[model samples]
Target: MATRADRRETNPDLGVLAGQLLFAVQRELFGSLAELGFDDLHPRHGAVLAYLEVDGVRATDLSRMSGQHKQVIGTMIDELETLGYVERLPDPADRRAKLVCPTERGRAEMVAADKIMAAMQERHARRLGRDTYAAFKTAFMDVVENQRARDLSRRP
Candidate 1:
């Protein structure tokens, strides 16, 4: 019998290894942030804060950008509100939709988190050597861009 894996063009072994490496990197990154008293944050919340940091966004827009379901995004928004990290504002353009904007406290938290993350990056760079680290970063960006391109291409 043919294996289901054979249906796909991509190599399953390489895909699994790539996912493992990505998860390992994320674990290290999240652990570093946890040391800075940000252990409460999840990956989804991070995506939301990063989105709001870039600009105020609607829940629908956040869902689209974060690749999260609207209901899940709503739950995240509820948690954020309770944490005093974000607030809902009446959308000036659309009466029915509320805009999600980060509060002052949220901005402060983001600043602190950024500092922690930057230090982590610097430490990793130091370990890898500056020049080698720079090359690695570029390669990582290339991989991300390529994956994004593939995703966009496959979208209907």
Candidate 2:
């Protein structure tokens, strides 16, 4: 055991651990994405890309899913549109609104990202034992959900 002179927290907290994990995975993912000829995409765009659906999704919904503001989502959508990864179409239900639809290139990127993330998760599971890793993921997600619900975040 170690002793500290003051009563300050010396260990990493949940936020630090989660943030480190996010950054490390993002660093690895973006590097691989570049090698795969997706150098145009950046980590900031992930707020939109990571939560996209096959059919289509609205920018407002993407904002909620990614826990980002609608303005941020709009900017990312614009960038993706310019890069030819996505397009906006009139919603069938409401012509007044538009749906953010992914193009073929976007679909390909999504598939690549999914494969990479699955591989990373598998590596960790192998290192930590499948059951333990599964339990940890479940518990962590529960904690996140609880905190989000309890906190005063702008998100719904």
Candidate 3:
């Protein structure tokens, strides 16, 4: 009787490998970002920060971007505000709504995150040849785009 583990051992799941690699990259990126003295900034908070860097969005919009609830995004925003990484300004279009913007500190953090990512990329290219790494990146992006399109089609 071949058990599930036996099957997995004999023919490991490539999807699992991809997922594990993604997680490893995220962990390294987050850890490197955190070491720059940005306290309590988890992956979710980082996602919000990155999003806000591009646009000043409302909490509801941020909730959608972060894939979190409005209240959760609000809570994270409050913490980020206290940390001086983000600030809320009154929305001109909707006076009742507040727009979130990343502060100078937040921009600095973003730059640090970029540096970390670049370092990681260079390390990956050093380990795997540059051409191989570039090919892998292209294939990964293609899969990501396909998955995103599939997910959108599946949405009710």
Candidate 4:
């Protein structure tokens, strides 16, 4: 291990590690997506597409789930809508509000994303040993959950 001073100079903190992982995953995912004709999508679009449901979801819920601001979600919705990936329809339960529903293109993209993610995970698991990869995921998720809980509690 490096000395304390060296570590401090180049500390790989939790945030840094998380961001690196995110960027790497996005690079791989988005590159493949573009090759498959989803050239319109970007890393930011993952905020909405990654967690979207087949039925539809509310922008507020997407914001909460993705830890993104409401305005950001709305803007992504608008962009996706214009790109013919999503449509905002009147929510049946609450006509006052709209639900963000995927178009056929969006659904197809979702399916492709699922396959790509699964293949990536499997590749990583094989490289790292399945058990070790599973343990790492569990540990990472624990960290994520704890941080999310703490952030939520601190919110006004």
| Candidate number achieving the greatest lDDT relative to the actual structure | 4
Expressed as tens digits, the lDDT of each residue in 100-145 for candidate 2 is 9999999999999999999999999999999999999999999988
The sequence of per-residue lDDT tens digits that candidate 1 reaches over residues 36-117 is: 6667666667657756753468999888777777898899999989878899988889888788988887777678767766
Model 3, 2: alpha-carbon shift in Å? 5.8
> On a 0 to 100 scale, what is the lDDT of residue 43 in model 2?
95
Q: Give a tens-digit lDDT track for model 4, residues 1-156.
A: 798668645987787779989999999999999999999999999999988888999999999999999999999999999999999989899999989999999999999999999999999999999999999999999999999999999999
Worst 10 residues of 2 by lDDT: 1-10
lDDT of each model, Cα atoms only?
Answer: 0.77, 0.90, 0.79, 0.94
What is the clash tally of candidate 3? 0
Residue 94 in candidate 3, Cα distance off native in Å: 7.2
Candidate 2 or 1, higher TM-score:
2
Q: Which portions of model 3 show Cα errors greater than 4 Å?
A: 1-3, 6-15, 54-75, 90-98
Sequence-dependent TM-score of model 1: 0.69
What lDDT is reached at residue 111 by model 4?
94
Q: How many clashing pairs per prediction, in order? A: 0, 0, 0, 0
Give the Å error, residue 97, model 2: 1.5
